[model samples]
Target chain A: MNSLMAIFRFELNRILTPGRVFWWVVVAAFPVVIMLLMMNYLQPPRGATQENINTFFTIALYFVAPTVSCMLGALLIAAPAVASELEQHSWTYLAVRPNGLFHLVLGKYLVAVVWAASATIVGVTVAVAVAGIEDPGDAQELNQDDTVVAATDDRAVRRGGRFPGETATDVVPGIVATGEVGRAMVGLAILSACSYSALYIMLGTLFHRRAMVLCVAYTAAVELFLGFFPAVINRLTIQYRLRTLLFDWTTQSDEFRNSGVLDFVSSDESAFMQVLWLVSWTAVFLAIALVSVHVREFTSASETDV
Target chain B: MTSEYLIELDHVTKLYGTVIGVNDFNAQLKPGAYGLLGPNGAGKSTLLNLLIGQLVPTRGTVRVLGQSPRNNSAFMKKIGFCPGFEGLYATTTGLDWVTLLLQLHGVRSRPARARAADCLALVGMSNDMNRPIATYSRGMRQRIKLAQSMAHEPTLLFLDEPFSGLDPVGRTEMTNVLNDWIGLGNSLIIASHVLHEIEALTDSFLLICGGRLLASGTASEVNELLFDSPSEIEVDCSEPYRLASVLMDRELAVSISVEQKSHGGDTVRLRTLRAGQLWSQLPDLITRNGFTVTRVRSADDSLQTLFNSLLKIHRGEI
Candidate 1:
C-alpha cells in the first residue's frame, strides 16, 4: 500500500507541474473554439429556433468532445508515463528501485483520467449553457416524426414533404418524453472519459518505449473506422457507448443526424447497451492496465555500448 | 549456505543464451565492507544484480541474509542500492525523489522528508535538495542517487561504480562518507575498476576476469597463489664473473648468470635463488670478498605483476 501510494504521488507530481498544466489548458480549448466558430457561421441570421439550435449543440457534444478528450489523455498521461520516461532514460534507474515501474503507470493514469473528464465536462457545460439560452426545452422530445419523410435512411419522414422546421408540431411530443439532452450528456462524458483513460493506460503499459505511437494508431483504428458504424457496430466501438447514452440528450429532429457527421465516438444504440459495452470492456482494459503497471520491466537490460 | 554469512554464493553461474555472465562463481561476503574489483564487462555488475535479487541465476543459489535473493521482499528494506547510471526524475527535486522512494518502503511522508534531508546532508547535497535534478551537475546528481539509497538506512549496500565519475575531491568526499556508513556495523559491496580504490576500503577482494571469479580473499592470499613458486634474485657485484663461476654448485639456484652492466662497466649482476644458501656456505664471501653488492628487487612481485601472474597461472591450469 505504501509503495503504491509513494509511486502514485511521484507519478502525479512529475506530470502535473505548472508548465504541463498550461499546455493541457491549450489542448482542451482547441475543440471549444472550433465548435463555436463553426456554430456561428451556421447559425440562422436573425434568430434560431429550438430545432436548429439543439441540432447545433448536439453536433458540438457528439463530434467535438471525444477527439479532445482522447488526445488530451494520450498527450498528458500516456505520453508522459511511457514515452517521456524512455526518452529521459529514467527507466534504468526505475528498474532497480523496489517498485518504481508500477508507481509510474498509476500516477500517469490517474492524472490523465481526471484531466480528460474535467475537459469534457467543461466543454459540454459551455456548449449546453449557450444552447439552452437559444432554445429552451428543445431536447426533451422523444420520437422526431411519425411519417416516413425522406424515403431515405437519413430521416424520420413525416406527413409533410419537407424536413420538419422549428415549432413543427411533429417534434414537440417527442421532446416532452425524453427530457433535455445535457443531463445524459454529462453521464456519457464521465463514462467515455473513464473508458478512454483505461484504454490509453493499457496501451501505454503494453508497449513501454513506443507506447505513444501505438496509442495513436489505436485511437485512429477505434475512433475512425469502427467509430462510424451504427448502433450494433458502435457497441464494439468506444465512442458508440458514450454516444448511445447521449442519444436522448440530442435535440429531437425530424431529420436523422449522421451522428458522426454531427458526432464521434457516438452510437445510435440504446444508452443502456452503450453503458454496458463501454463500462464492461473498459473494466477488462482496466485489468490490463493494472497488470501492465505492476509487471512491466521499466528498463531494458541491454546495457548500451558506446 | 551458512547463516553466519550475510551473503553466500556457491558455484553460481549466470548465462544469457551462450554468453556467460558469471561462470561457476563462489564467494562468501561476511557482514562488513568488501570491494568487488573488476574491469568493465568483468561481471561485477551482474554479481551485484544477482545479490540484490534483481536477477535470477542459471545454475547457482545466491543467498542474501541467508535467504534466496530472488523476490525476497523482506530483505529489500535491508538493502540499499546506488546504480551507476545515476538517473533521477529531472522534474522532481532531490528531496521529492528521495522522499518518494522512502515512502514506497512504508515510510510516512513527514518522516521521509526529514530523513531525506538528513540523507542529503550525509551526501553533502542538503543545500541543493530543493533544486530539480536537471539543474544538478554530474557529481551532484550522483550524490542525490546516493542519498536516496542511504535514506532507507539499509543494512547491506551495493554501489556500482559510485566513484567512477567523481573528481578526485568528490571521490575523497565519497570515500569519507562511505567510511561513515561502514563505521557503523553495516556492510557494503562497492564495485570499481580502480585497484587503489578497492585497496583503500577493503582487504578482501573478488578479482574477476572474463566473467569468472579468478580469486576471492585478502590481497596476500591472492598473491600467494601467484608467487608461491621460488623467485629469482639479482645482485649487482664488483666481481660478477668470479661469484657466478663459484655458484654453479648451489642446489636451489638451478640457473645462474653474470652480466656486465649495460654501460660496460666492471659491475656484474648475479642472478641466483636463496642468496642466504650461498651466504651460509661461503660466509667469507660476504665480508672478505671484494664484492660491493648493489641491487636487490623481486623478480616478479609488484601487485600488478602478481595479479597478472595469478591470471596466467589460472589460464595455464584451466
Candidate 2:
C-alpha cells in the first residue's frame, strides 16, 4: 500500500510538467473552440428552430465528448506512460523495488484516467454552455419542411434528428435540454476515458517501443470500424456499449426514433448492464497491463540497443 | 547456497539470445568489501544486474541473503544497487529522485525527505541537491545516483563503475565516504575497470574477463601472480655502473638499462625474474658500493600488469 501511494504520487508529479500541462489545456479547449466557431460563423440558416439547435448539440456531443476529447486525451497521456520510462532508461531502477512494476503501472493508469476525464469534462461543460447561449429555448417547435441535416455519419445525423411523434401538450416535451444532454455526455466521457486509458496502457506494456503504432491500429480496426458495424462483433467495443447507454439514459432514443431513421443495433440492454460491460472491459485490460509488467523483461539493453 | 555468504552464484550463466552475458560463473561472496575488477564489456554490469535480481540466470541459481533474488522483496529490502547507466528522471531534482526511491523502499514521506538530504550531503551534493538533474554535470549525476542508493541504507550495496566520471578530488571524497560505510561494517561490492581506483577502495577483489571469473584474492596475492614475468624496477643512484656490476655479478637481474642523469646521478631500470631475490640482496649491493640510493620503484606493481598476468594464467600460458 505504501509503495503504491509513493509510486502514484511520483507518477503524478512526473507527468504534471509545464509543457505537458500546456498541451492538455489546448486539447481540452478544442471542443469549445469548434462550438464557438459554428455558433458565430455557421448560424444554422437563420430560420432554425430549437429542434435544430438540439440536433446540433447532440451531434457536437457525439464528436467532441467521446471521439475527440476522451479518446485523444486518454491516448496522449496513457499510451506513453511505460514506454517513456523504458526509452529514458529509468525502468531498471524502479523494477528492483518490491512489487514496483505493479505499482508503477497502477499509478500511471490512475493519473491518465483522472487527467483525461477532467479534460473531457472541461471541454463538454464549455461546449454545452455555448450551445445554450446560441439558441436559448424560446423556439422549441420544428416546421414540417425543416430538414435536420448534421455532420458526417448519416446514422449519427439520423440519431440527432427532431422527434415527430410528440404532441405540443405532452408533459415530456419534444425539445431536448442542452444541460441534460451535457450530463449524459459527461458520464460517457468519463467511461470512455477510463476504458481507453486501460486499453492503451495494456498496449503500452505489450509493445513498449511500438505502443503508439499498435494504439492507432487498434483504434482504426476496433473502435472506428467495428464499432459502427451492425453485427455481433460491434458489441466487443466500448463505443458500442457507450452508444447503447447514451440512448437508454437520455430522451435521445424517443427523439431519434420519431425522426424516422431506424437503427438495426439493439438498444434493449439496460443502462446498468451497458455500464457494467464498460467497467468489466476496463478491469480486464487493466489486469492484463499489470500482469504484463510483472512478467516482461525491461532491461536497459533491451530498451536501447535491441 | 549457504547462509554464511550474503551472495551466492553457483555455475550461473546468463545468455542474451546467442550472446553470453555471464558464462558459467561461480562465486560466493561473504559479508565484506570487495572490488569487481574488469575492463569494459567484461560482464561486470551483467553480473551486477543478476545479483540485484533485475535479470534471472538462464541455467543456474542465484541467492542473496539465503533466498532467491528474483522478485525476492525481503532480499531486495536489505540490498541497494547503483547501475552503470544514468537512470534518472531528467526533469526532477536530485533530492526528489532520492526521496522517491527512499519512499519506495517503504519509508514515510517526512523521513524519506530527511534521509534523502542526509544521503545527498554524504555524497557532497547538498548545495546542488535541489537543482534539476538535467542541469547537473556527469560527475554530479553520478553522485546523485549514489545518493539514491545510499539513502535507504541497505545492508549490502552493489555499485557498478562508481568512479567513472569523478575528478581527482571528487574521487577522493567518494572514496572516503565509501571507506566510512565499510568502516561501519556494511558490505559493498564496487565495480571498476581502473585497478588503481579499486585499490584505493578495498584490498580484496574479483578479476573477471570475457564473462568469466579469472581470479579472486587479496591485492598482494593477485599481484603475486605476476612473479613468472620479469618484474621491472627503476633505481635512482649516484653510482649506476657499480650498482649494475653488483646486480649482474649476482645474476639477480635479467636485463638492465642505464641512462645518464643531467643532475650528476644515474637512473637505471632493471628487469629481473626474481624481484624478491634482488630486494633481499639490495642492501648489501648498495652498501658494498657505497651507493646513495635515492629511490627504488617497482614498475610492475600495477593493476594492469596483474590483470595481464591473470589472463595469461587463465589461458595456461604461464
Candidate 3:
C-alpha cells in the first residue's frame, strides 16, 4: 500500500509537468470553447425556444464532454504511461522494486483517470454555466399543442431527451432540470475516462512503440465505429455501455427511443449492470497491464539502441 | 539459511533471436567487491541484466541472494542496480528523482527525502541536486545515477559502466563513494572495460570475451593468462647489431633480430619465453656495453592478445 501511494505521488508529479499540464488544460476547455464559439459567433436564433437551448447542451455533453474532452485528456495522459518510461529508460529503476511494476501501473492508471476526469468535469461545469438553459415560453402555453413537439424535434432532442417547451417561468426550472441531467452526463464522462485510460495504459505496457497508434486505431474502430455498430461486438466496447447508462440514468430512453438516434444504442441493460461492466472492463485492462509489466523485459540498453 | 553465494549463474545463455547475448556462462559470487572487466559487446551488460532479473536466460538459471531474480520482488529488494545507460527524468530535479526512487523502495516521505539528500551529498552533488537533470553535465548525471541506486541502501549493488563519461575528478569522487560503500561491508559488482578503474575499485576480477567467461580470479591470474606464451620485446638502440649479437647467446632470449628502424635508427627485437629473467639481463647488457637505447617496448603485453586467444580458444582455434 505504501509503495502504491508512493508511485501514485510520483506519477502525479510526472503528470503535473508544464508540458503535460498544457495539453490537459487544452483538452479540458475544448468543449466549453466550442460552445462559446457556437453561442457568440454562430448566434442561435435570438428567438430560439428553451427546448432548442437544452438540445444544444445535450449535444455538447455528447461530443464535447465525454467524446472529445474526456477522451483527449485520457489519451494524452494514459496512452504513454509505460511507453514514456520506457523511452526515458526509467522502467528498470522502478521495475526492480518489490511489486514495483504493479504499483506503477496502478498508480499511473489512477493518475490518468483522475486527471482526465477532473478536466472533463471542469469543462462540463464551465460549458454548462456558459451555455445556460434559455427561458421556456409562456406559462399559459404549458398546454400548448403542437409547438412543444415542433420545438423539441431537432437533432439534439432526437439524440437525447424530450424538452419541456412550456412557460417562460418553467424555463428556469426546466433549465435547472437539464443542469441535473448534464451533471449525470459528467458522471458518465468520468466513468468512460477511467475505462478508456485503463485500456490505453494496457496498450502502453504491451507495445511501447506502437501504443499510440494502436490506441488511435482502437478508438476509431471499436469506440467510434463499432460503438455505432449495434451488434454483440459493440456491447464489448465501453462506449456502448457508457451510452446505454447515459440514456438509462437520465430518463431519456423514451425520448431518444421515440426518435431514431437510440436505434443502434438500444439495450435493456440496467444502470447498475452497465456500471458493473464498465468497472469490470477497467479492472481487466489493468490486470493485463500488470501481467505485461511482469512478463516483458524492458532492458535499460533499449534506450541506447534508440 | 539461503545460499551463501550473493549471485549464482549455472550454464546461463541469453539469446536475442539467433544472436547470442551471453553464452554458456557460469559463476558463483560471494559477499564481496568484484570487478566485471570486458571489452564492449563482451556480455557485461547482458550478464548484469540477468543478475538483476531484468532478463531471463534463454537456457539456464540465474539466482541472486539465493532467489530467482525474475519477478522475485523479495530478492530485488536486497539488490540495487545502476545500468550502463542514462535513464533519467530530464525535467525533474535530481533530488526529486532520487527521493521518488527511495519512496518507490518503500521509504516514507520525510525519511526518503532525507536519504535522497544524503545520497546526493555522498555523490558530491548536494549543491546541484535542486537543478533539473537536463541541465546537468555528464559527470553530474552519472553522480545522480549512482545516488539513486544507493539511496535505498540495498545489500548487493550492481553497477554497469558507472564510470563511462566522468572526468578524472568525478571518477575519483565516484570511486571514493563506492569504496565507502564497500567499507560498509556490503557487496558490489561493478562492470567496466577500464582495467585501472577496476583495479582502483577491486583486486578481484572477472574477464569475459565473446559472450563467454575467459577467466575469473585475482589481478595476477589475469596477467598470467596474458603471459602464458613467449612475450616479444623490441629495443631501439644506437648499436642494434651489437645488442642483437649479445642477446642471441642469452638463454632468456628465445629469438633475436636486428633491423633498421622505420625512421632512421637501428633496432634489436627479441622474443623471450622468460621476460622477467631477460629483464635482469637487459640492464646488465646495456650498462656493460655502454649502449644508448631510445625506447624499450613490450609488444606482446597487449590486452588484444588475451582477448584474441580467448575467443580463439572458445572457437577451438588454439
The window of 10 residues in a row where model 2 chain B has the poorest summed lDDT is: B222-231
lDDT of 2 by residue, A1-306 (tens): 787788778887887888879867876888888776655555444454555456655756667776777888888878988998888878878887767777788888888888888988898887776654322222223435543332333332233322343322221111257667788888888898899999999998898889888898898898988888888898898888888777665554345557643254434688899889989999999999988876666674442121
Query: What local lDDT score does residue A142 receive in model 1, on the 0 to 100 scale?
Result: 22
Give lDDT tens digits, candidate 2, residues B88-174. 888899998998888888889999999999999999999999999999999999899888777788888999888879899999999
* Weakest 10 consecutive residues of candidate 1 chain A by summed lDDT: A170-179
- Stronger candidate by lDDT (1 vs 3): 3
Put down candidate 1 lDDT per residue, B178-215, tens digits, no spaces.
Answer: 88888998898888778777667777778887678888
Candidate 1 residue-wise lDDT, A1-306, digit = tens = 676667766766666778867766665665566655654454332333346445545655556665555456544575446666666666545544555555556656667766776776676666554333322232222224322122331222231112434333333211111136556655666776777777877777677567777777777776666776543565576765565565555554554464344354454556667677877887887688667654543333443210
Q: In model 2, where do residues sit more than 4 Å from their true spots? A: A37-56, A133-139, A142-175, A253-255, A258-267, A302-306, B233-254, B259-268, B272-298, B312-318
Residue A19, model 1: lDDT of: 80
Q: Which tens-of-lDDT digit does each residue in B132-196 have in candidate 3?
A: 99999988999988998888889999998899889999999899999989999999999888877
Order of candidates by DockQ, top first?
3, 2, 1
For model 3 the TM-score comes to 0.84
Report lDDT per candidate: 0.65, 0.78, 0.78
Candidate numbers sorted by TM-score from highest down: 2, 3, 1
